[model samples]
Target: MNIYAHFSSIIARHLAALVAAGELPAGLEGYGFTVEPPRDPSHGDLATNVAMVLAKPAGSNPRAIADKLAGLLRAEPDVTAVDVAGPGFINIRLRDDFIRARVPEILREGTDYGNSALGSGQKFNVEYVSANPTGPMHVGHCRGAVFGDALATLLVKAGYDVTREYYINDAGGQVDVLARSAFLRYREALGEDIGEIPQGFYPGDYLKDVGLALVAVFGRTIRAMDEAEWLPIVREFAIEAMMKMIRDDLLALGIKHDVFFSERSLHTDGRVQDALDALKAKGLIYTGVLEPPKGKTPEDWEPRPQTLFKATEFGDDVDRPVQKSDGSWTYFAGDMAYHYDKIQRGFSHMIDVFGADHGGYVKRMQAVVKALSGGEADLDVKIIQLVKLWKNGEPFKMSKRSGSFVTLRDVVDEVGKGVVRFIMLTRKNDAPLDFDFAKVTEQSRDNPVFYVQYAHARVMSVMRKAAEALPGVDLSDAALAGADLGRLIDGSEIALVKMLAYWPKLIESAAVAHEPHRVAFYLYDLASEFHGLWNKGNEDPSLRFLIDGDKDVTLARLALIRAVAVTVASGLAVLGVEPLDEMH
Candidate 1:
């Protein structure tokens, strides 16, 4: 029951009637208007700006159009009142009984209540957590991992065919450093006195296990090879081991990707050159000398001709380099081939979740998709901000096991997976978040995860008490839905129903904006409303879910609370959070 959509269609019909009657200008369909909940609830249940939106186009006064539209809405079913406010805003109020009647519909839908068909089965690719395959995943990667996973789940719920992917940065120079680090461990395993790790080497003890494994497989044969011969072999072995550790760590957090694309494969199979050749065909490839970058000059800056792509022709600030002066493919060339591969695989929409440090890379990547697909495809990039670690309000130190950064496993092992996932989403993707160990685990209303979970658990507790207090009373959802809901005359009861009805619209808007943190904010507000109603019953004994010797009233209140539970559970599922049935 999408109440917002229902009213929107009604308003559209009335506007069409005015257009046919010659009271308003024709071609009113071109005007874009919005139907949404009013910021102040006392204004009305739903408000529309259709009259204001069409006033300029139709060459008529806004209030006059609003007055005519209000009269038409007043004759509709269940619309009790319509008011034309300042500047021709139409606020429509529905009958309270009409809102109460939606409880049964919510009970039947359960967790599927807020499901939407906004995407209409369009294929979408969400690429995130593409961390370098050189060591274990750090706490910085945790934010992007959870954000991407939850966003993918939200798109799926909104009816998009989503593919969660992880891109491996194995072809970079970082992996070569990892290979050299593992070689040091390999020498130490062979009973040699390996001194302190040099300036550029990784110093984590985790590589000691990799060294031992290499000895088990290649034995003494690797010792006789030169640096050039052993670099590639050790690089391959080290990358595979590090990726396994990464996969295990992600599994601990309940994150699994559908695709793990290798950057090295793009170079090995000639896709990089193939992508450049395709650009050359479009006349976008050329030899040009770029000016010095903004601010200071780079160390490798030189005034020479380089192969470049016409990135500025699309939307980027300047043209980008596709090949360096040394006749080697640049990093941007690999990215173009990767996206071309995605375009070939039939994805019209793509979302990239990047770290905070990659802010400068957004414009060029978007330009690449637009140029390559000839405006047939679109790309959206979300930059995830950093997460600060705190223990009882003091900054936490880094983990020695990870050499320099705190591993994702250390955070998950300290608190469970659900807590980490929920807390990470409490802030928007572009805003920095502070994850404190002391505050998140506290059993209080200040803790949003616990507050929301307690609301679900409290409803379950109420059901248990209903079974004991009123024996053979049929406390199931079906029986509750069939109860005399007219007995629910309180303002709080009707407010909850309105909140529950807004779930479908919330899902649609959040999915459209590609913002998943809105779900966390909505859940917190819903839980607060439910908790407020529960506390109201504490003062007035008659407002409680279970009233002595009053079966009809008790069942009516039970239906109201059960509807709240269903909506909360449905929202949590979209955020990849499990609603708790009991608090420990």
Candidate 2:
């Protein structure tokens, strides 16, 4: 149960009653009223600023309103004490039994304890790792992939209908380069000695398998064909093979997208034209000259008029070109069409996760969506920063030309999926992350993944030991629901329960901010609390889970540990990292 929400609703109802009874003025909005844990535990179990928020509107002093609200709240069976704190803040101390009672509710809810409906069932589209399909994914793509997936899972927990999508850049010059690169590999597969990769061509050996497959399928059939004739066939084959590799690599890290949007499909069967027509109908699309871009305009730039969108009208720094002088659509043109298609498919909330190098593109993209939807659609672009690799305290270098670039598969293979996923998300998306192969694999407290997973594993160990020692003591809901949690009275025991109380609030806040790293940090804090309690038990016999002679006390303590385990499991699941039951 969400205790904060429960108390806020009760306080709001009482205030509304007061307003109706003429004790407080009408038309004073109470939407800003909130119930949150006090900074100091001694102050109260919860605090609310309702009196302060309503004071000016009600034509009353904050302290006066707080005193009146305090009296009203003190009458409730759950509220044991209420004090008017500094300048109208009301501090509430709930009956000890009220807080104790939540233990059973948590046991009943299990892993679903902190699930919330904060999103109100809104439909959201999350596009991440839309990395170009020219080659296998590298370490740089890992963070966004994990972050976006976890964010989608968090949104789902917050009751949003989330669609995880990957936009494939398959219709640009990059793809054409990919086609030519594959052709070289195709020649190499036919025993032709193609020397060092030519300039502007991909030099990785990842396409070797694709070329081998091409030889097996085409079997010299395209030898007599011109580049134009062979280009399409080879490009399609290479793209499919590369995407398969990408999907497999993502799978290795336990990531899967619900949708894979192909940029090429936007231009297929006139879809791009249709999208442009829709924008044109709204008078957002126009053919006009764009002024030379400020700050480092190309020296060879000529002031020729080109077709441009009025992006500046929607808050972009400058109007952006849709078509270039070569009569080809710019990259931004395809992106606009893609987003418009997403809007047409009924997603009013859209999120695009891009690399930090694309930071300058965020405003323009948001402008496009705003202009296209007439401000109805909301677009949030999260730019994930670069990942600096280190191994054994030395900078890890991966160069494609030297054939040493660390592929996604390499990292996954070295550390396994769980470590990779957890470590990737341990940092904020926009902050540069230093991922050391040595540090992450270490089973120490400093390693967050290890610490968190160790907490889960420790809980399981306690359960196993308890089950063996106390035969027939039910760990099931029916039994745990009847737990006498008042038996858990130690300071550390109560502190652990209080930490559990923050799960709902943490979930709501993290989801609201669209920050999955917050979840990672929360899990770290919770793990720290669990570890502290576990360490304390080593010193204080009463704090231990197995109170050797008392079944009720043992069961109560087990119930608390189980609650912690459930919350940890739920948080890790949201991050798509498997909760370990045993640490090896």
Candidate 3:
């Protein structure tokens, strides 16, 4: 399935054999070499730098090594010819039968063809879209949500046990503000003539239902209590209500997290204190007076005594404070506890997706994971950049739903979840993404998601047509696996198979890099090639997928097209997009 890996192993085995035969020096073992498709396809089908890597180690000239290696490699049954390219690089051309042999395997596997067992069952916890519970999710949260969810899917395909998580910032002052905002709505529900919402309070109408529910529950009797007494009761209720609306918005976009951890729980259960104590035991906690930031000093900046963490000892620019001068825990303190909680839950690898504005907070967080897990756990934070919405080639105006910034549901309603997820991943996480309604919804070749789906639909159309063109033939996968694939010897047909051969290797490399955007890129490239092949049939009748009299050739081409469709469906699954059977 992984031809690159297969050939790389082949080269390694040959290197060992050469050493055993005294051709290569004994100490030349463990030389690193890479096998990949040549950047220029004209060079060969597969190319490797094995000679260049082992020449110096073996104390032999690279050209001499390549000449001997080429002769041995040409003897492989899977390889048709071997040549030494410039500077002693070995390029091996696979036999057409070797490429065609994989077609039946792809047809039989369906979407499971590219699944890898690279992780060996290691656990990974990905935390993203941890939007504050003070309000509904806005468009700012869309990229992280899609990126993290897609990444979790990619990890699962790579054989890692993935748990998607969302961290709630409910214990902060923002939730207190939320409680007050709901109380104002509570008064509004009671028919009180409250004027316009004052400044420093959330003015959104999302809390109107919460107010009515509060009235229905306890009526006005609960309003007479002091603010201190009533704040806790309202805070608890508002958080639950806000989280429900947030969860609903996520569901609209087909995002669901396995865990929703609360920062409040850390305080209530003494986890924060325990985490700080753990750091102190390692001599990473300290008391100090910090200096002002170089250029971002607040107007009220002053050197004050505070409890700080030894963040600089691990790699941070400066030590970070864990507690304020008022003796209250800082947000970073809660964050440290959150990471500790993840390590305690037996997660050896963790990833946090943050907004681009949180870039300065990355190093310290990594330091926390290293300090708490004793360098055993690694935390990688992917900063998601801004997304600018566009329609009709102009900047999109306001959202009619919230009448302010666009909400995640607003975009989903405008374009379906498939378009939203696919377009969000069109660019890297740290790069700006342009979500254009006009371009994304277009049914032309320029639209990647649409083009990919159209390929799948086209494959279905051909299958139905092929059944009618070639009567009394078994076209099922089990039957096709036994077809005379040796008839598929066209250069274009062989090229398609070579592309499909890269899927398993692509999945493994992309998963290893923690870059899910690569999946979108691969799917786009695969679709482009398939579409080009589909168009070629209009000019060359022999290249067409179905033939009137040639049943054998037609069946072979149909098998090739089926493998393309199956591979596209498999790639789209990793991106969390459903491949359509038919497009309206």
Candidate 4:
């Protein structure tokens, strides 16, 4: 239950009743008001700006309105007291019994405590990690993969029907180059002494397996065909091979997409023509000459009329070309068809997670969705910045062409998948992240993954001890949900409850913003609250979880820590990070 949302509804209903009774002005009913926790906890449990927002509209002083509202609010259940704070804000103090009641509520809910119905089962299409099907995934692809997966999981937790998708750039020139590269390996597999790979060809040894597979499937007869005859077969083979490798890499990180849409599919069965015809019927596609790009216009650049999309009319910076001078479809044209396909599939909400280098293409892609959907759909593109790897403060670089760049598998193998996924989300996707091999594995408070995991592990430890300390009393969630939670009145104990109370509210906001990193930060803060309460016990024996003779307070506190563990696990599951039950 979101306490803030609950109280906002309460305040709204109270004002409506006041308006009907002629105790408050009539027209202030539709005002959007806020009821949130006060910045200073000493003021009250919750605060609202209802009086200040209504004063001028009601033609009365805010303090006068607050006084009347305070009396009415104080009569509400669980509201112990309500007072007019400075200028017109209403500060509300809830009864301690009300605060204590939430502990049992949380224990009863377990990990499902924070699940929300914000999305209401609306379909959401999330496209991410659409790396080319030309090579194996590198460390460069890690952030977007993790971020998109986490965001999809967050949407699911928010009660949306989320489809995780990957778009394969298989129809481009790069795949043809992949075909050529595999052919080199193919010849070598047949005992031809092919020398060093040509400069423009992919030089990675990954295709050697694809080459051997070709030899095994087609044998020496495969080499007898002309370039045109063999290129298609090799290209298809390499695309599948590369896609398999990419899938394996994603699986290593605990990521799996529901759909792997092929760009080539857009070209087949007249789908591309169908998509373009839809745009053309709206007069959005026409033959036109693009103005020279600013500053870096090549000396060879000249005016040439080309088939272009009316991207500018739909909020893009410039009209983008959909077809080249030779009348062949451009890359943007394929993307247009793909997005149109998504709209046709009835996805009203779409999100694309792209690498930082794709930033410039964002506006035009958004324009395509807008134009194709006739403004009936929404598309959000999130760009992830670079991840600079560091070992001992020195920069680490990896490149498959040079066979020196780090692969996603390398990072996962070194620190394990959980560390890699958690660290990727520690920063916003648009911000540059520095991942250190040494630091993430460090068992310290400064390492967030470690700190959060340790919190979960500590909760497990507490549960084990509780089992021994109070053997006669059942510590199951059902029994604990019936605990005398009012026994947990210590300052630190209440503070931890305050943090736990915010979980549902946090999930709602983070889902609305389409940000899973917020969940990561929230988990850290919750862990901090849990850790702080644990540290407090060492100073005061009264704050301890297991009081020798006080079974009631001990059970209540156990329910509190168990809620934290369940909450942390729920949030980590959204980020695809596994919470450790034991640190070692």
- In model 1, pairs of residues that clash are none
**Which wins on TM-score, candidate 1 or candidate 2?**
1
Name the best candidate (by lDDT): 1
TM-score of 4: 0.95
Q: Compose the digit string of candidate 1's lDDT tens values, residues 1-584.
A: 88888788889999999999999989998777888999899998999999999999989999999999999999988999999999999999999888998899889888998888878999999999999988899998999999999999999989999999999988888999999999999999999999999999999889999999999999988889999999999999999999999999998888999999999999999998888888888889999999888875777566889999999999899999989999988889889999988998999899999999999999999998988888999999999999999988899875658788999999999888988999999999999999999899999988999999999999999989999998877888888889999999999888988888888889989999999999999999999999999999998888898999898999998998998888889888877788999999
| Whole-model lDDT, model 2 | 0.87
- How displaced is residue 579 in candidate 1, in Å? 1.0
Tens digits of per-residue lDDT for model 2, 171-254: 988988989999999899999999998999888888888889999999898867899999999999999998998999899989
Clashes of each: 0, 0, 0, 2
Task: Write the number of the candidate with greater TM-score, choosing between 3 and 4.
Answer: 3
All candidates: CA RMSD (Å):
1.5, 2.0, 1.9, 2.3
Model 2: how far residue 340 lies from native, Å:
0.7
Considering summed lDDT, which 10 consecutive residues are worst modelled in model 4?
396-405
Which residue runs of candidate 2 sit more than 4 Å off their true CA positions? 55-60, 297-300, 398-404
Tens digit per residue, CA lDDT, model 4, 1-584: 77888898888888888889998878886787778789999988999998999988988899998898898899998998898989999999988777777778787787787888889999999999999987778887988999999999989988899999999999999999999999999999998999988988988888889899999999988699999999999999999999999999999999999999999989986678888899999999999898888885678579999999999998999999988999799889899999999999999899999998999999999999999999999999999999989987898654444254678888888889999999999998899999988789889988999999999999999889999887787878788788778788888888888888888878888888988899989999999989998888989888888889888888888888888888898888888987888989
For model 3, name the residue pairs that clash: none
Q: Which stretches of candidate 1 lie over 4 Å from their true place?
A: 297-301
What's the lDDT for residue 144 in model 1? 96
| Model 1 collision count | 0
Candidate 4 global lDDT: 0.89
Scored by CA lDDT, what does every candidate get?
A: 0.92, 0.87, 0.90, 0.89
Error of 4 at 195 (Å): 1.4
